[model samples]
Target: MTNDVIIRRTIEWMEGHLHEEVTAEDIAAQAGFSKFHFHRLFQSAVGMSFTEYLRLRRLTNAALALIHTDERIIDIAMHYCFDSQEVFTRAFKKVYGFPPGQYRRQMMSLMKMKEEKQMEETLKGWFLSGSHPFNYEMGADVETVHQGKQSGYLKSKTVTPAEGEFATMMQQFKADRYRGKRMKLSAFLKTEDVQHMASLWMRVDSASEEVLQFDNMSDRPIQSTSNWNHYTIVLDIPENSAVISFGMILSGSGCIWADSVTFEEVDEKTPTTNLQTEIVMLDEPVNLAFEES
Candidate 1:
């Protein structure tokens, strides 16, 4: 199987068996990779170690349960395989920047206020537009969130024959802080019956809004149907970059859900998926022969 398929299946298995206590060996076996090799590969592609990813996913699910249900804190902890409430609380706080109890209370309060105000579920810091806005719908959704009671969703509302037609929810901001650095954009995505494809995209732009570096996950497109999975795009923001823009895009028919987006500075060791290729300058042209170096 392709590495992408293997990774997807491994993640699916991890999601289904989150409540169980499984080690790296088990996960590697499930993915059909040796434990040692999988460790490196998983960290490289997913931007985190297997253990860390598993723990964070569990904590994320626990966070959801905390907000959605009235279950006891300790019970929720146990359900996700935490050895004790204290351990769970430490992990949860580290990841979410708040204790479980506090997170629950604060999120519940905010959700309540949103509902009371009858606020439309919309992305606040994003600019939503598309080639055919009339043929698509985009908004934040509370009912079908991946975590924390809300997620940004997009769906094609009407059929269109234009191959170039697309709907996108995007955000752009000054690249001052990230200039001359490698940045990774990671998000969890879920899709349904995608007619064309869906992708998480990022681009570094010059002052004139010309794209300098870009990756729309085109090398490995998310097409057809898919369950919730983590996807990421990494790009270098050159010193000349002025803005960074990114978001989810959908072409043709289908729906996509995006949640838990994150950005981080990465070292050069992380391969960039930028569509632009660097040109190599040769000292002299020599290889006119059939076989020569």
Candidate 2:
């Protein structure tokens, strides 16, 4: 299997059995890899060690439970496999900058203020659309931001199991100024329980809306829960390219936050990550006079 597919399977296994005792051996076995090799491969592709990812994911869940559920602190700790409330609290505070109790109260206070406003808030200069808009929810979240005062959150509904459909928070603008230049689109992404994957996608189109270049991070996906990190998509804008449209998309069931999006022009030294090739340069033609070689 491809590394991305293997990592996706491993992540799915980990998410399914989070409450049980797990080791690198177990996860490596799940992905059909040797223990030693899988450790490096997972870290290289996912940008974090398996154990670290698991710990952070469990702690994230615990934090959310503290805010949303009526579970006690010790119970939450035990449920997430922490040895004790003290250990959990230390880890939680290190990541979230607050103890569980204090974090919950702070989150709730922030949420209360958000609840006082309309449930669906636009993301200002961005728009939302997808195959199943009704199956998704979009909003600006202040309590769970990676930078600035808020970030855009996209949530998928549990009832819709359509893997082909996606929810996207997008923005589009004229690309006349960026024509004939290479563009890099990047953003910070944080995800929770991503079943299929989440991606930073960019597309360049003609005046008629025909796509000229595109990359959706499909070759390398964020298939599991992860801490905040940067992801990017780079594509060259042809002289005829008219519109530049980009977005963060969530597939299957999960939640993702997009923060600090940036678009900039780059020189030819930077390679484009566009999946669709505009030209194929071959050493020579393969067929002549319809004769077999």
Candidate 3:
């Protein structure tokens, strides 16, 4: 199997066993790799070590429990396999910058305020636009998230959207820092009842508004319902590129949640998903003669 597939399967396994005791040695054995080798591979594929990923995921879930449930903090911590309340508290405070009690109180207040405002609010650094943007509601979803306290979401407001109608939640910024580099955009996405399609998209545009590179995952669109899954788009930013724009687009009816979005520069050895690079052109006209066939 390809390394990507192996890593993905390993992550799925890890997610399923998050509540149980797991070790790198055990996971490596299951994957048919030495512990050391698997550690390196997992880090390269996931952008973090296995132990760190596990800790963060556990802490994220614990945070959710703190927000959504009235369970004792110690119980929530123990349920996630942390050794003790003290250990969990220290780790949680280190990441969240607040103790469990304070974090829960603050998050609960924020969530209550968010629900009161709901669709009337706009996500900072993002805007809604598409063929029929009014037919959709885009905002932060605190209840359904893949990681962290909340995720950004877009959902259809009407059951009978006009044919060919669509909407996108997008952001654009100066591409000066990424120019002349291969940049990767990664995000976890979940979908429900996506009738047409949904995709994570990115584009690099030149100063004249010409497309420099772009990919919308058209060849592998997300349709129907799906659990959270990691997706990425890689593209080379031309030196003349002036803006980088990206977001999730939902076509037709459905809802999609996006979380943990990130961008990082990658080595040239990493293949780009830029759709513009997929087209083939000849340096000069060839095979003009019928005999060439």
Candidate 4:
């Protein structure tokens, strides 16, 4: 089986059995391997360790449950294997931006609004009452669903790609999957004048740090906006990589803004994609008013 397919299946198992006593060994077994061999391969292939993935999985679960159900905090803590409410609260607060209670309250407000909107639409007899508002509210933001009811989270975004001279600007990643292979992005720099760049900022899946930022530094400055503006960043898709997804941010006065960025790796059978969505990148015109001049 391919590494991406393995990791994807592992996540499937995680979603179904998160309430059980899950371990790296358990995941290794689920993914069809022994711990010793699986650990390294899993980390290298998925860009994250099994344990780390479990923690993230737990946090993601807690966050969703906190909003979806009115279950007691202590129950949530216990279910996710936390030793105490305090511990759960601390970790939840650390992962999300707030305590469980606060997050639930906010989620309720958003869900309420969504439901209200849906109610209005349904009353107009557009569809059937079998549909729900909360579904849209939590869809993308929460667990995975094949089809039917989707979570109510906002979906990915889109933007126009920029153009410069190396000859032309092209959509290289385009939602492609590398499987067990490592892929790199390459763009050309005609000169040494760079006020714009490619950066990768993930939620730093470690409990030890609040956030970590990595900007794949290019050797030359974007001396001129005239060249094709070629640039590239190698993505380390290790089995234990901490990235939720990737994004591209653009800086400059080119009237260019990144829309949603997408890489074609959603399915289990391939290694490349022609589709694109963005976790981050310039899609529309950007506002630098907030940046310090």
Candidate 5:
């Protein structure tokens, strides 16, 4: 079902079944793809995960219902499979930046779910004549500064990179597209120089004894030193593949943070490094930015 017609046809079917309890298996069977790969492929093609797409679609439908009918807000929320009005309100506020009551009061005059084209502009940290909530593209100007006990800054790579190189990176690691690809991603960092460098590489080979492999510099002959900068890499993976083991060779008493990372799965042409979202806060994120204090 590589044909866009088939994929879209299935999406069209999904459009009619928002209230039905849906699962990845159902979509995979309908789309003629393995449940494993279908999830990844769907996101890559639609620029959002199947689960996320479905949720957004449901919310979008609810948005319409909220305005068109005289139905109670609680009824609309429950009809959309939300457990309670409070839960629905929280999620609505998170995504739409306004409660459903406010939206209905606005007379459906505004649409908060951004248009697809708006994503590219929003990626550039721009919105309708201004900035929006998420600004990952702003990373283009964000240099990797020294955050730990180190006294100096880091030599960061140019945030913007080639499309092909980035595409390969995205698909090679996207578990949906790359589950079959089975790539090994490794990261390294050093604090010896005033400037710390973070290097990431991947090797995808199925013929070898180890289908997937990962080894940080601390594991090899490379030693963790006072000049050593600790780093971590999280794989945004599906729950079915959650048990994959992480082999590590830690040298000191710091910490190894193990948590799932979430990311956008855009079209085949989109670059993986070009983050589709970034969570901004006063405190730095350890997952995206490593700490060596």
Candidate 6:
């Protein structure tokens, strides 16, 4: 199997066994890799060591419990495998910048105010559009995020969506600054129950809306489910390009969270992920007659 598949499966296993005590050595054994090799591979694939990822994920879940449940802080800490309440408090405070009690109170107040507003607020600087946008809900999920305070999400509202139905949370802007440059778009994404597919897409268009370059990661779609992983697409912005558009797309039923989106210029050594291929036109229609075959 590919390294990515192995890491994803290891993350799934780690999540399932969070309530129990498991060390890097045990996990490495489970994955059939040596301790030192697994440590390096995990760090490279995830951008963090296995222990750190586990701690942060556990803290994230604990924070959620603090917000959504009345569970005692100590119990929540213990449930997530923290040794004691003191240790949990220190770790939680280090990441969240507040003790559990204060964090819970502040988040609860903010959540209550949000609920009172009773309206679906569109994510700023982004819009939703697709084949069946009404079948999906798009929003900023502050509670469940890959990093920082929030992450943008697109989730299927209807389980029985029609075939080929999809939705996208996208944005477009003038491409004047990026013209004639190789640009790379990267984001951290997590998926759940993605029945069909999810992808990060980008397109460079001309003044009249002709696609000059495009890639939707169709060759490498995220399906079923996956833990937070970084994905990237690179394309050259042609001189005639007028607009640059990009977003995350979800087809069929599923949920996807996107965070830490970034765009930067890359050197010529970096290959473009553009899926558009050159088209050759024939001089004339050669198969007009049925007997030609």
lDDT per model, in order? 0.84, 0.81, 0.87, 0.45, 0.43, 0.87
Per-residue lDDT of model 3, residues 1-293, tens digit only:
96766776677677777799998788887667998998998887667887787788889889988999999999999999999999999999999999999999999897777544544465788888889999998998777877777899999999978889999989999999888999999887889999999999999999999999999999979999876766888899999999999999999999999999998999998888888854688799887785785
TM-scores, one per candidate: 0.72, 0.61, 0.85, 0.42, 0.37, 0.77
Give the per-residue lDDT of model 5 (tens digit) for 1-293: 33344555566666667787778788778878787787777755555676776677677667667767789999888888788999989977777677999978774453344243432342232111111112111111111211111111122133432221211011132234545223233222332221221232222233332334332332222222232222332333322332233322222122121111122222334323211235467665465555555
TM-score of 4: 0.42
> Could you tell me the TM-score of candidate 5?
0.37
Q: Any runs in candidate 6 off by more than 4 Å, and if so which? A: 1-10, 24-50, 116-122, 192-195, 224-230, 264-271, 280-293
For candidate 3, report its TM-score: 0.85
For residues 40-159, write the lDDT of model 4, one tens digit per residue: 866654456777666766776777777778899899989988889999999888867789899889877877786424423322211211112122111122333111122212111122
As a whole number from 0 to 100, the lDDT of residue 227 in candidate 2 is 64
**Residues 124-207, candidate 1, lDDT per residue (tens digit)?**
777667788678777877655555557888888776537878888888889999998999898889898888889999888899
Backbone clash count for every predicted candidate, in the order shown: 0, 0, 0, 67, 2, 0
Worst window of 10 by summed lDDT in candidate 3 = 114-123
Candidate 2 local lDDT, 129-216, one digit each (tens): 8888778888887567544346888888765567587888888899999988998886768899888899899999999988999999
Displacement of residue 144 (Cα, Å) in model 1 is 3.7
Candidate 5 lDDT trough over 10 residues, lowest sum: 133-142
What does candidate 1 score on TM?
Answer: 0.72
Q: What's the lDDT of the predicted structure labeled candidate 2?
A: 0.81
Best by TM-score: 3
